[model samples]
Target: MNRLRANDWLFWGSVLACYLLQLMPLPQALLPLKPWWLALVLMYWILEAPDYVSLGRAFVLGLVGDVLAGELLGEQALRLCVACFILMRFRARLRFFPMWQQALAALALLANDRIVLFAIRAVSGEAAVPASYWLAPLTGMIAWPWVFLLLDDARARARVRES
Candidate 1:
């Protein structure tokens, strides 16, 4: 029975910010290193506030992301659904871990996302993914700490403001 949180606006704001970040253009050489912003934000919500961000929401978000990115329909939806499924399965343990360990978990989750991306590209007969394809997860791992801290601080501030 997860009611709408008072800080729900903060959650949606951060998600919109992530989507905007994901859409930002990057230099060709730097493109492979851009962290998966949407995945990181979704993982944070899933880990910290599972009741608010459920599997169905993840699927819907993924579909919207797919359309925005001009990707094959249902591609991101399936990947995000899988990510949510795993996160939800392990939420009991992950939710309580220290931030560093949680970042490690996020790293693993982002890696899973990359694997899914690779499979999708292969199946679609796209150019072989470069070896640098693995860099995004590592970049995402590095960014997780900062993203978590900022979002957590924002959520806390929003709670205090509401109170």
Candidate 2:
């Protein structure tokens, strides 16, 4: 049987911070370029502790974002769920990949999330957002390594404490 790991309070703390950060007001000029902070945190936890947080958690967070952002209901939730599910399903292989490769995979996942959101908006006849909506994935891809390293360090510390 797998050994018991410590509770992931730090992980959840970071996740909460990410969500709060997402809700923070931004300058109108920079709003379009803001990265998907909540999505990034969800991806991090899904990769690090699939047992702790799963697609359902991601979906709920996305739903909260949808309500806060005033987007169509279930829009972000569906995308976040699909993204987390895919990440969890392939996590073992993903863990072995190099940092750059993993970031690339994350970028692809984020792109997929955007596509789903875009498709949903189109179906509902919402006005098309600017091309800048695509930039979030790229920025997220760049920021992922830092997030991974920081969270992984926390995981390592947690593991050591448990032992």
Q: Which model scores highest in TM-score?
A: 1
The TM-score obtained by model 2 is 0.86
lDDT of 2 by residue, 80-128 (tens): 8888889888888887899999899889988888898888888899857
lDDT, residue 100, model 2: 97
The pairs that clash in candidate 1 are none
TM, every model: 0.92, 0.86
Winning candidate number (lDDT): 1
- Please write out the lDDT profile of model 1 over residues 47-108, one tens digit for every residue: 77776678788889989888999989999889988988998899899988998898899899
Prediction RMSDs, each to the true structure: 2.2, 2.7
